[model samples]
Target: MNTMTKRLTAVALATTLAVSLAGCSHWSKRDRNTAIGAGVGAVGGHVLTNGSGVGTLGGAAVGGIIGHQVSK
Candidate 1:
């Protein structure tokens, strides 16, 4: 594959990973933390990756964490 195709593939793979993890379960602090970390990581990752669409999953992850921030 060419350089462009490889970059596209990397972006696509990252996008898929980001989206697929959305709406993940949060039954424990560990699970919650993992989700938050991944979500924030995705956003940072997306920014680092210079992707807009790919950041939706990251946003959701952060949103979920924010939503659950009050939970025990």
Candidate 2:
């Protein structure tokens, strides 16, 4: 990837982090757990796939489901 792509990825990740942090204070424990799971899944996916879009999305979806189920 080029420098521009890397910069854009960084910006997107930063934006996601900022938004997630901003809304957490008002969320229930369940909601916070799900979000945390998704974030971890995204990072895990990125690492596992060398930052492939499919892997990231798959990880987020799977992580979200697992997190939601665990909250029950």
lDDT against the true structure, each candidate: 0.59, 0.74
Worst 10 residues of 2 by lDDT: 1-10
The backbone clash count of each candidate, in order, is 0, 0
lDDT of 1 by residue, 4-70 (tens): 7646755676676567656555347656555656555555555554555567466656655664664
Minimum summed lDDT over a 10-residue window in model 1 is located at 41-50
| Pairs of colliding residues, candidate 2 | none
lDDT of 2 by residue, 15-48 (tens): 7866876867988878877876777677667656
How close to the true structure is residue 39 of candidate 2, measured as C-alpha lDDT?
Answer: 71
**Local error of candidate 2 at residue 18 (angstroms):** 7.0
Give per-residue lDDT, candidate 2, residue 53: 94
